[model samples]
Target: MAAPTPRALRRGEISFKLDERTAHSSLDLFKKDTSVIYRIVGIDPTKVPQNIERFTDWAVVLGDTAVSSGRHYWEVTVKRSHQFRIGVADLDISREGCIGVDNHSWVFAYAHRMWSAMLANKTTPISNIGHPERVGVLLDYDSKKLSLVDVSKLELIHSIPAEFQGPVVPAFALWDGELLTHSGLDVPKKLSGN
Candidate 1:
């Protein structure tokens, strides 16, 4: 197969990065492999810290800012050895429960040899993906649409319409063997008419 062409961003595409302070206060629940990468090898019960609460599953982190209106885009590179979930969540999303099991987050996850989008207890399988190495997120708050792109192949993995009740922030979860690399952050382009 031929190499996939890089995708061109539409006007007004905005970007962001992870905010360490707001990254689920329990982020230390997992381990940070590098400055911008993390590994979730499961929390050690015996070593649990006093102030940090233990999560039954998954380690989550959020981006720096809460976006209420705009077209935002960001990309994360996952090593592909294990599963990962990436998307946006309402500012008040719970840090204790599984990310997508609640109403405040919308995430696209890859695990158990499959890709799926989850929102409020619903898991919708997105077929035909084979362990994407990098994922791109395109969030349109005005349209209430969130789309995930397979960056390596330049393919749209899934696009779901969501009701983002308020300001939303970029969030992600990591599992064993997953190394998340924050790829790029785009500045919101000025629109011609706006």
Candidate 2:
């Protein structure tokens, strides 16, 4: 019998930061880098700004704002680089492991021309999608649905139902000199008194 041919895997779209508004948007996430290398330039009426970074390794950062309920959406720009992950995770998930390795987190990964959704250490392949210049993320906490979108063409890439145990925060990971710029952050209104 003849050997079977390898199944071709579709490569996800590579995106760029077309939205210049981020330069003035309010950033809700930052980390202790060699310096304050990351910054937010602008934000929308919702007060969510784009997260921008030139690309670094072994770095994980969480949004200062936490969302326990309601629907949320955000965009990430990866002007360059093919290895990075973006998603939401529980406030207490271990940063040591991969982003989507456990039930504590749900992340979308794109590399080597394939897009996959990971949760609870399970990975699902999403096909027929090319790397776009931008990717949008939608989260419906009440319904436990998380989706990834091709922002440049306004197309749906994939959606997964997630059962989260507690509050979740937007999470980002990058390494080996890869840069990712993300936009759209849901900022909660602060009360007058603590």
Candidate 3:
């Protein structure tokens, strides 16, 4: 029998600043070296500027932002297969400081489609949390699944299945002592994962 292949390490990355718009510049998640930025389309850390080309890690372009170890806020876009990810981070670029501040710029990239091109890669592509205490849980388009994980620990907290509608992306909210979401479909289902 053939030996099983080991799970590949999912590399995430992002360029970030402490407060580009609301406050001064800083990367709180900074540790010793640059951290990988992941993807999360719709969630907290809202009102970010649009139309900026997603950060390129494999790009050969000059002057691209370098990965640093520190705390920083960013707009994360998950790009494992489609390469459509964006976000910010405060990296430590040092590679020596292992412990990081991680105000939680470590973005999450999930999809409703289980067979999404991104999933083909090794990374879990977690969703970004909305606040320091809140989380960023999104629906995968391919797999039609929902997962909630801690942005700091990168632990899978919750997960559920959901399908894709059309142009409208699924938006989640907590109400009536339950977690419900607008499925971006005509008849939205009241989803509550146990």
Tens-digit lDDT string for candidate 3 (101-158): 1221222332343211122123443333332233334333344344553445545444
- Model 2, span 138-157: residue lDDT tens: 76777787788777655567
Which candidate should be chosen as best, given TM-score against the real structure? 1
Over 4 Å off, model 3: 1-132, 170-194
> Which 10 successive residues of model 2 have the least lDDT summed?
5-14
**Candidate 1, residue 61: lDDT:** 65
Which residue runs does candidate 2 get wrong by more than 4 Å?
Answer: 1-58, 176-194
Query: What are the runs in model 1 whose C-alpha is more than 4 Å off?
Result: 1-15, 22-58, 181-194
Give per-residue lDDT, candidate 1, residue 126. 93
Tell me the lDDT of model 2 at 188. 19
lDDT, each prediction: 0.64, 0.56, 0.25
Error of 2 at 21 (Å): 25
RMSD of each: 9.6, 16.6, 18.4
